[model samples]
Every structure is written in C-alpha cells, then in structure tokens.
Target: MLTSIQNPLVQKFRRLQNAKERRETQLFLLEGTHLIQEACAVNYPLMTVCYTSKWEEHHPELRSIVLENCDRVELVSDEVIKSIATTVNPDGIVAIAPRLAQKKPPIPAKLTIVLSTIQDPGNLGTIIRTAAAAGADGLWVSQDSVDLDNPKVLRASAGQWFRLAMGVSDNLHELVTSYQQQGVQIVSTTSHTQTSYWDVNLTKPTLILLGNEGAGLSDDLAALADLQVKIPMETGVESLNVATAAALMLYEVRRQRS
Candidate 1:
C-alpha cells in the first residue's frame, strides 16, 4: 500500500489542487466513488485511481470496473487519499482525469445559456446541472467566470458537467453579435426590466444571458440584448439567486418547446 504522502504520484495529485497546475498539466482531481462511476459511465478516461483497502472491500464491483478502465490503480492508505483530496472525508478514493476539451460545437444549437462572470462554483455547477436537465443544447461562459474545472463545481454539478457541451468565450460581445447576426435572440435577465420572463417567446432559438451574483448584467451586455426580462416576485423580495433565476428561465424554454 502507498503509505507515504511524499510519494511522487501523491505529490503530483496534490499539485492538481491548484488551478494553474491543473491548467498546465491538463488534469483535474475527482473525488468520491460516485464521481468516478459517473466518469466511467461517460467513457471519460481516467489516468489513475487511488483507493484504500476499505473502499476496495466495500465496493468490490466498482473497484473492479475502475481497475479495468483506468491506466493505473494504486492501493493507498486512507491518510494518503485525504492528503490529495479537498473534501473533509475523501470517501476512500480519488481519480485524475483530463480537462474537458473546449470544443465549440459547430452551429450553436437552438437553446443556449450564456453565463457572464458567475463567481460561485456551486452556482456555476448547479446551473450546468439545471441546463442539462432542461435540455439546453450548450452553455457558453464568459472568460471571467469561475474555472469550470474547480472541484467544488464538479461536485456540485453531480456529474452533469460531463454530459454538457460547454465552452468559454474570450469575447462575449463578439459572440453575442455573431449570434444576433445568425437570427438568434439574446435575452437578458434583470430586475429593472418591465417585461416579465413568461411574456417572451422562448420558442425560437434563444441565448439567455445571466450575470454575476452581486452585480447584474453589465450595461453593454444588457444593451445588446434583444429582450430584457424579469421574474416577477412578491413586493419585498429584491431578486432571485442566479441559479434559481436560470432554472426559471431555462424551464420556461423547455415548457415552450414541449
């Protein structure tokens, strides 16, 4: 069993915790058995898997499946697993997988989500999960948004990230302009808008723009939108959480399409 935390492979796994390191190495850490299973289900290649004997015994079938697919598997001590994992409870296993490639799909689909400067990893991941569930064709995030590969994002996504087609846009203005030229309507969400979200015709090809949590959409982005919409709430309530707002907007599209 790999007991020493100083082991070369263990140290390498530890380095993956850093965003810059993950970017440079093109690898990220995935914790817990469920995530490993999800990766395997999607045929996501895992370079290595580190597990403890207790985990192996409890999940013999899963362990065998992981061993069959992974390039290498190591029997490590619980302490070693904890050292590389970001979670309080490592759940006795961790796997390393390549970063999802940023391949923009040709012909952006009818329904798309454009996220601008979403700071919270949980919010980002939740949006991804909701988008996938709502049948959004793809998700486009602005360059300034949270790193998609963050562990918290991955965990919060509940494995939906692997299924979603997502890419980061370096120039959101240019992207919106291109979409608009193609006859795709850009819909922006904000409280100041008089138009209720339900009134908009989401049946057509649409790109829904969501902004940062504290600050709403940037003025430039808001100005470029084909329509600005707001979800009507009670008198005292100010606004909804970004993720909650996204769910409402996306499901409206789904409802319209259905």
Candidate 2:
C-alpha cells in the first residue's frame, strides 16, 4: 500500500496534466477503471498504471490485465490520485497511455471526414466518436488539431478511437484532390454559403471538411469543396459549433445516401 502523495510516480502524473508537458512528452493521462480496462481489451499498450489501495479489489479486470500484461503498476494513496487528474472525480486510478498511430483511410471513395486545425480536444474527440457512430469510412486529423491522446479527448471519445480508422496528416488538400479525381464530391460546411445542406446530393462519394470553431474554413480547403453548404438556422444564431455542424452535415449526408 503506497501511502505517500509525493512519490516520484505521482509527480510524473502531475506533470503530464499540463498541456505543455503532454505536448513535449507526447503522452496524456487516462483516469478511470473502465478506461484502463478498455485500453487493455484493445491492446492499446499501457506503459504505467497507478491506482489507489483498493483498485485491484474494485476492478478484477483491471487487476488481471495489469498483472498479466502491463509493464508496471504503482499503488498510491487516494489523495495522490486526485492530485493528478483534471476531472472533479478521479476514479482512484490513472494510466499513462502511449499515443497509438491512427489508421489510414480504408476506402478513399467512401464518405470521409476531414478536420482542420481544430484546437479543442473535446470537439475533436466528439467528432471522431460521431464519425465512428455515423459509419464514416475514415477520418483525417490535421496537424494543427488538438492532440488525440490528450486526456480530455480520450475521455470524450469513450474508446471510439480504438475502432475507427484515422490518420494524422498535413496534406488534406492532396487527399481531397485525389478523392475528387475519383468522383468523390468534397463538401465543406460554411456559414457564408446559401445552399441548404439537405438539397445537396450526398448519395455519391463525399468528403466533409470541418474547420475551426471561430474560423469556418481555410481558403484552400474551402476552394476545394465542390459545394459549400450551410445548415439553415433560426435567426438568433449565426452558426453552430463546429462539432454540431459536422454532426448535422454527416446526418444530412447519411439521410440522403439512404
């Protein structure tokens, strides 16, 4: 039973909570008994596991995974576990998970979701989760987008990242161009465009581009969109959250395709 709160392992966890440290180290903290179990279930390659005194008793699956496959396990005090988490409730356990390489797009001809420089980890994770749910062929994570392994992203995604085929690339334009050549229509969401999203034909091949929350779309990406579209909104609101916009566009496309 590790009683001290100032252990070296605890300090490392504390450091990784910072955005700068996470970026520098390319690692994020995942806190939750089930999340740890999910990672092990998917063979996500756990580097370290830290938990309070009762972790093993509380979660047999986690204990089994840790004892059988994990490289290291550090037992710490409940107070120590709380110090390293970003959430209000720490769940008495946390793990340092290595960032897995995202899979490349499987079928370039199918519906593709392209996210450009989306800085919010929560939005990016939610988009990925939505993409997985919407049955998109694959997803693109632009270089400027938030770190996929960031704790907030992992928590928001709810383990969807393990199943979806995703890629981190800087050449979204090139991919869009290639898909276009193959008869795929690239649709970019924009508040400026007048075309109703439903009217567009999404039954054919498509690539949907979502831009930053404040900035709708980059000029280059927007130029590539075969048709720029807008989700008709009530008068009070000018636009939707980028994730919301993407979800709306994805739903419209799916509705038309069916």
* Per-model C-alpha RMSD: 1.2, 2.0
Each model's lDDT comes to 0.90, 0.81
Encode model 2's per-residue lDDT on 121-225: one tens digit a residue: 889888888888888988887888887777888778788877778888788788778888888888987778779889888988899988888876789989998
In model 1, which runs have C-alpha deviations exceeding 4 angstroms?
Answer: 102-106
TM-score of each: 0.96, 0.91
TM-score of model 2 vs. true structure:
0.91
> Global CA lDDT of candidate 1, please?
0.90
The digit string of per-residue lDDT tens for model 1 on 127-244 reads 9999999998889888899889899999998998888888898988988888888888999987887899999899999999989999988999889999999899999999899999
Among these predicted structures, which one has the highest lDDT? 1
Regions of model 2 farther than 4 Å from truth: none
